[model samples]
Target: MSKTRQHCFDFGVPPALTLLLGLWGITRNNSMWRDEAATWEAAHRTIPEIWSLLGRIDMVHGLYYLFMHGVFTVFGDRLYCLRLPSLLAMACATALLTLLGSRLVDASTGLATGLAFALLPAVQQYAQEGRPYALVTACEVLACWLLVTAVDASNWCHWAAYGTTVLVAALLNWFSLLILFAHAATIALARTPRAVIARWALSASCAVLGSLPLVMASQAQSGQVSWIPPVGLGTTLNLLMTVVMGALGAYLARTRLASGSVRVSLSALALPLLALPPLLLLAVSLTRPLYQTRYVLFSQIGLALLIGAACHALASRFRRQPRRSIVLAAAVALVALLPIEVPLRSAGSRVDDVLSTADNVAAVRKPGDAVLYIPAARRDTALVSPGAFTGTRDLALIENPRQSNTLQGVEGTPEYIRKAMLTARRIIVVTDDNTSPPASARDRTKEQVLRSHFIRRYETRERGRKIVVYVRRADDRAATPTSRCPCFVRKGSTPTPPGVVPTEQSKSNRTQ
Candidate 1:
């Protein structure tokens, strides 16, 4: 008897449903990452505080906050539910890309475009993340569709849609302004006559100028910031690869040569037009202060479209040289994909890993035991208290009176060493090897401060997250060293200074 072969359901479902299912799977088990945890806290602001909060910390994502205010009303702020909106937004983007690809290029191109976006690693990563990236992606496709439609004619409605879309896109993420530059550059390469190009350019220029006020406000609020160094040939090539062939963006120059259609090539070039200008500016900023990879994501649209074109152009290679194209695309896609999914899976897997670790370590009620954050790593695998491992009540349950205003990443956080040591039944501070002096220095002075000053209890490392528990020896209790005591400030500053209390924290702030 012949085995019954199962056909994939993606073939039968409408693009819209397939798109949603794909996004849902990507987002399904992704526990909220740290930055996303922060966003959830901010977006659920009360109506009275919403306006003030939007202007203060979040100038660009104001419109999204307003939408999330609606999300909070129904979903009531669970992490998965809060992130549901972003996944839905990404699904909309996949559907729109399919329609746009089909309408702008051809049916096969359109079908592939939707499928490509649906499976793309970057799209998958952001769809799972609990932030505004998916929403921005959605706005990007809609804006591009609107702009392309408007350029085809002077349809007043399309132009109006273009304006509204531009404003909403900008509000979702300020970098959406880069779309204007992409449009300008693409129009120049368009086979459209110079007269027509000039007319379209003028129209787009007006639309961008109209958005100047909001853009200027955002710029002033953010202040000029940059850290990325000048992008060399290597970085440029890497970015180009990521933009054009989905994960193929990693090996841009290495990929096989293909003859891209004029439409596709022009579209591909739009990516550099959108991203390169800002990237170059960021490179120049390396000398002064401002570049973060995340801010420039809106530019990836040009890259994504370009990659779709490249994929379409090069896909036939897979048919002829089945071994070559399949092998190359597979290897590149796998390498590019690991950096995202692997990390996500590792982090998610730790939910159980941390729980298992908790089972073995009995909570020893030693009086000096404290929950110390050794050297204070930038992040930890799990945030919840280790039930048996720490032998103390979870800080979440602790009546932390001052948590209301405890800003994340503030300089003074690790200063709680002294207090945690004195109070915790089994004191344990977690840290990685980050704080040790360079090997050349071999500073025993600093090393002694840790070993002699703080009594070591237990140390463990699993999958890069480290936990080191220390106890304040009974003799050391009399010393009352400021380093390990609560309210005991680090040498330079007091833990709770005179005027540092919360100004007017509400009930919501207490929950954090």
Candidate 2:
């Protein structure tokens, strides 16, 4: 092919491939995981409620939740509808990555990078998630592209576009702001013109200033991430391996004919964008636990670009036998990526696998039975179909989650929970498999009350959750015999719905 034709081919094919790859299993009806469940809960609320929620927690995600609110408004709550934004955003990111790589190196390298990005397990994983990370990656990649254009042209219009995108990325996820520091490395490494440097600085300053309110709010709500563990040796080693491999891949992508500035800028970018966030997060985590792999997911973009460049360089080495060599190289890469792609397409791939959990619950639950979530967060298992638990009670529930405008609704106090538990003939307890025995005071009390009064009937364990049933002892009659919980009703409503409460017919269906 002629040079012009090759460049056009490189520009067009990768994005189309990325879109096809991203949409393949995008609608796999996997149960919404905990975080996505949280998104569902928040997005379903009124605008005032969502704004009020950000004042207390998840301020970083407020914009994303609002965006989803608009989506859910038009699309309803279908699984595919919720995930479509991510699918589209990931495709956009893949295209932007191609453009960014081409700007840094050449069109062929850009195409290779886009293909590599589409195949990355992490990218595939988030592309299907109903959360903000995929959007964050898209905006960050776009911001990088704009930054390069702004620097090259030293134009206020391009700088403004870059700055605006930076703010949007930061608002979508505060962790995305870390990219500015990586961009700073690019600026310094290339010794960009003084006018370009001033333009870059102004754009960055605008981004930071515009995003300041959200940053402060998120800081105050930092405890939401307290579950993240302090950095240690194992984590340090893992990050080191990721950084070293990424740098090596980028180094190999370098060609003898590429511009000096492009090579230097690519080197500066691939390393820090892949390495700096985790290291800075690790350092901060030494004082406060804030490090998590998902927060730095955008880093994978840099790694993928480098690896793609390397692929292009390798294919170019056989210049005398180009067509066959490139085909073989592409085939080998696809074969290598198959293992990672397979699981990502399945419902069982997620940690919580809420669909399986719900199916298990539906199979075992009897009428007149009660359900309890060990840590309360496990209530996500029921969120998708509140009606699935119809004819039964949630013993510890204080308010219906949607009614209360909370993630999974509130749990009653331990004393109230124990009292609530005593009324039911059978109870189902959902617990996290990753946690050990005696998870919380509520969990410990539930275990103690059940063991002391009932017998364990059956247990089922899953990848990320466990479910166990307990039946009331035959001799026990001291406890009250209420057939339904009062808590599931909307506030101020008087009577209970019939099928939703336990009945003889419901009990007969269970016995049979």
Candidate 3:
């Protein structure tokens, strides 16, 4: 080999290599996702009492948000700050995978494992998210180190560490336990042995016992699982296939250039690739809960391991025939992944569009004008959060102001025109609505509900968001600068939402 080639062959420093790899994957896709918007909202919280406010949301990843608070504090909350934690956590996950693989197999296997993990679009997407997926990936891999140790030594500390991993994984996202179940099932099959298994079981029980306090909190607070669209068998299978096959394709791409390696690769890949997916599918099915591809990120390492195994199996198959495993793997990955990445990224684009419109809405708030927001259908916070006018207190979120602020839900049919004509001041009505009622007040069409209620007075198009401001009248000063406004703008630092009681904010006599 040439000297330059030989120099390139030398493995670089581990941490930097992981950092560079993670950065590449994260930046490869820049689209935002729905959950990411929520993270951005949480990370940009402003009230001193935001921690209390955040607790009400039932998001399982409180620790992730706290760290994000610190990041936003320094970096001045923006997309990068929202995304940086996931990026760094992916780097850490890669390093941990390398460590775990090296111990289980060898240096070559470890490097191959890391390389495969780096190319996965799923990993890249989550790694750039503002949520907890990447960090959970890191913890899952680290737990493996302790699990392997506990298998042999049966020591208290090792067992304790293994259990601690279980606790952390469960707390971050309950679905994380799905991966734990997969690993536990694999252990129970006598693949390793009986006596060692018994020891691991006892250790696991202790971990569960220790975690009872935290888990109970979840159980006590657990409301009825939210409504989920019925998932067919096809969707369930496709989700599994995508996670498994997509990961394998990424691994194959990473290791296609390898010359000779079988044992090192297969062992490293077997545990993750073959074990995690089906088990997770079964778990979700039992609960009848909604299942999306990203929720399984906690078990992604297992998928990487599976890909490593596939890499060896393919390489060996091709070795004798000399056909085209590397070429085939590359072809398959691009075909399977590129198509899916487009739509997934499209969903992310929609999320960005939502935020952009929010910025547009914020830019147009006139400081004291009545801010009328008719949430055409459901009360989605994303649409409303941006309506908050960038952290100011001068806006009132009005549903129907033509009626008295003291008036609650209307009972009798006074009619839509009466409601429309009651506002006699300068006001802004914004709706991406779908509410349809008889006696159409604004009448754009059948599909367009709120379009009929008010006439467009001011429209601002900026940041991918369209703020179509409407009003009943052109002259009334509808709001005061001292009233509370929705919080939809970027923050100057990391913050949390204020925990102002809804009742207090809604009191009829409190407004100016």
TM-score of candidate 1 against the unseen true structure: 0.64
What TM-score against the true fold does each predicted structure earn? 0.64, 0.87, 0.66
Better of 2 and 3 by lDDT: 2
For candidate 3, the TM-score is: 0.66
Provide the overall lDDT of each model, using Cα atoms, as 2-decimal numbers: 0.49, 0.76, 0.50
Ordered from best to worst lDDT, the candidate numbers read 2, 3, 1
Off by over 4 Å in 2: 1-8, 257-264, 320-327, 475-512
How would you encode candidate 2's per-residue C-alpha lDDT over 237-282 as one tens digit per residue? 9889988888778667655224534434566666778887778888
- Which residue runs does candidate 3 get wrong by more than 4 Å? 1-34, 43-51, 74-76, 190-195, 219-227, 240-287, 316-354, 362-368, 372-453, 456-466, 473-512
Per-residue CA lDDT of candidate 1, range 179-212, in tens?
Answer: 6666666565555565556555665666577666
lDDT: which candidate is best? 2
Candidate 1 local Cα displacement, residue 230, angstroms: 7.3
**Cα deviation of 198 in candidate 3 (Å)?**
3.1
Clash pairs (backbone) in predicted model 2: none
lDDT by residue for model 3 (189-230), tens = 326666767767776676567656555665544552353445
Ordered list by TM-score, greatest first: 2, 3, 1
